[model samples]
Target: MSAFWRDSLAGLCALLIGIGIARFGYTPLIPVLIQHHWLDAGDAAYLGATNLAGYVGGSLLAAWLSRLVPVARLTRIAMIITTISLAACMLPWGFLWFAPWRFLTGFTGGLLMVAAVPLMLSRAPPHLHGRSNGIVFTGVGIGVIASGTLVPALASEGPAAIWGGMALVAGLLTLLTWPRWTPQPGDASPGTRGTTRAFTRPVAILLVAYMLDSAAFVPHTVFWADFIARGLHRGIEAGGFYWIFFGVGAMCGPVLAGFVAERFGFYRSVTGGYGIKAAFVALPILSQHPVALAASAVVVGAMTPGISALASGRVAELVGFAAHRQVWGWLTGGFAVASAVAGYLMSYLFDSYGSYYMLFGIGTVGLCIAMLLSVFVRNPPAPAAQAA
Candidate 1:
């Protein structure tokens, strides 16, 4: 295969191990942990939040560390750390013991997410940027699909078995992608840094909207499987099936959103994506009918990554390419902070109320606010206007 494909595959593997397995692989296992008495419902919820918290640190760390370390080297080390964290979780020593390992997984995952895509994109030919991104982010969906399908099958064998299986998969991906990572000449140079004041009115509006999107999606990402399995009494198999639908939608979301953005423009596409996601996220609260649940699963899943792509493009449209990386880093950092906060807050509310309905309601409201905020985001001034 060509170098482009090699880099894309390696990036894909990094994401698959990082966000896919490290972050999301734990979702389906939430029900299993509670069911097996390895952890209570509240502890499981908190553990999930812990990973999100670790992700916040990792995302911030990746930005600073990239200046000091080669992006490819950092990504490789992250994957290795993520694999180790997965293996470490198999010990089954309880919540305190498992929390740190889960945190490590999230940290490494954040590092991969922030570092891996750029590493691949830097090597990609200009014409192939879009296609290469699709290939790389597709790893997230593949990882979700693997976890959603495999966890239930392994659940019968016990949680340790599930952890072992995930570790094994992560280990194989690490080995396969290891040598494919090559450093770019620019990797050694510390690039220009932009100020936070780049958050002009339009950019600030967009950033807030993006942060709300992060907060709104927490319900599905953190609690969907548990809601289906425990909340509805549907069992782990049923939960996994819906999660499979989510995975399928996730796989299609970014590509479909990219096409829509190219046609309709990123601004309108983001607004519509948020509106649609809000409606679907609230669907479970309105009705638990099998069809309603499936639609919710699919649409919300699609919007999760779909909206992200649109928002990133929207950022570029607002700030131009030179500042896009810096602005986008702020955007990403905001997202991680929101997700971490929402995850913990929702977990607390769930523990206090013992209901998933409130969580979905909160997500819906946040997205609705985001949709409104997105409507106010105007485009950047023309070059001539800026110069004047």
Candidate 2:
């Protein structure tokens, strides 16, 4: 097979193990953990925050290491670490162990995302970059679907069994991609920073918008399952069902975003996406009817990865490909910080007020602000001109 297919496959597997299983696996398992008395609501929030914090750390490290390590090696290491961390969560050692393990898993996710996303995009021919990114990120949805469907059934088996199962899946994916990760020749010099442009107004605006978009997603990613299962007194199975729809939306989000962005431009596509997402974010607050909630899941799920794919495309459009590796790291790190902050804040709100209304309200406001900011993002010059 061609290098393009191999790289894309490797990236998909990396994301599945990293973001899907390591970073997001915990969210679906929240209801199970709480029910099993393995963790309290507050502890769940703390664990989530800890994981995001580790993501921040790992992202920054990836940025610094981009010039030092090959993407293939970085990805391989991250996948292995993510697998180990997932297995570690299955240990009966309690929160002390769980916190570190979760953090480690998220750290690996951060590394994999920063390294693999741009790597995959860079490997694809320019015309296919947007779709390639969307395809790679689909792993997140696949992971979510697995967790949403598989974890609920495993809930009766206990946390150890559930976590162990996740580790096994991640390990298998890691092995599948392992042989193909041999270093590429001329994989860009480690230190070849993009001199095409510096951080300008548009880049700054895009980063802030991306950051807010990240924050806006916290309510759903961290708390949606818990909210349904615990907040609405819906059974875990119902919550899982909702989460499955969420994953389904995510699975398709990138492809839709890619098509729209290619036609309408990334700026318009992102603005419209955020607008739709913001509306859905407010849905549960207005009405928790099963239909409204389900719609909310589908819309929000689509936008989560959709926005990500669009944002990266926009970044590449603005900064040029040579700069993508470094810039992508900062963008992802900013998102991680936002996610961490939102996780802690929402966790506190849940503990103090026992409601998600305020969280969704805040998220809606943030998304609106992001949409407004996106309007200012002008299309950059053609890639050849930008690279020149």
Q: What lDDT would each prediction earn against the true structure?
A: 0.86, 0.83
lDDT score, candidate 1, position 321: 65
Give the lDDT of residue 166 in candidate 2: 94
- Provide TM-scores for the models: 0.96, 0.94
lDDT measured at residue 13 in model 2 versus the true structure, 0 to 100: 80
**For model 2, which pairs clash?**
none
Off by more than 4 A, model 1: 186-192, 383-388
The candidate that wins on lDDT is 1
Looking at candidate 2, the ten consecutive residues that score lowest on lDDT are: 189-198
- Assess the local accuracy of residue 83 in candidate 2 as a C-alpha lDDT between 0 and 100: 82
The digit string of per-residue lDDT tens for model 1 on 191-275 reads 4555444568888888898899999999999999999999999999999889988887887888888889989998899999999
The local distance difference test score of model 1 is 0.86
Question: For residues 1-388, could you state the per-residue lDDT of candidate 2 as single tens digits?
Answer: 8877777877888888888777777788988888888888888878888998888888767756766778778778888888888888887776887988888887888888877666666678877776677778899889888888878889889988999999999999989989766677755533445533546678788889989999988899888898899889998888888998898898889889888987998778888988999999999999999999999999899999899888877877787766765666678889988888888888888789987888899899999999999988876756524583
- Candidate 2 lDDT at 172 equals 94
Error of 2 at 36 (Å): 0.9
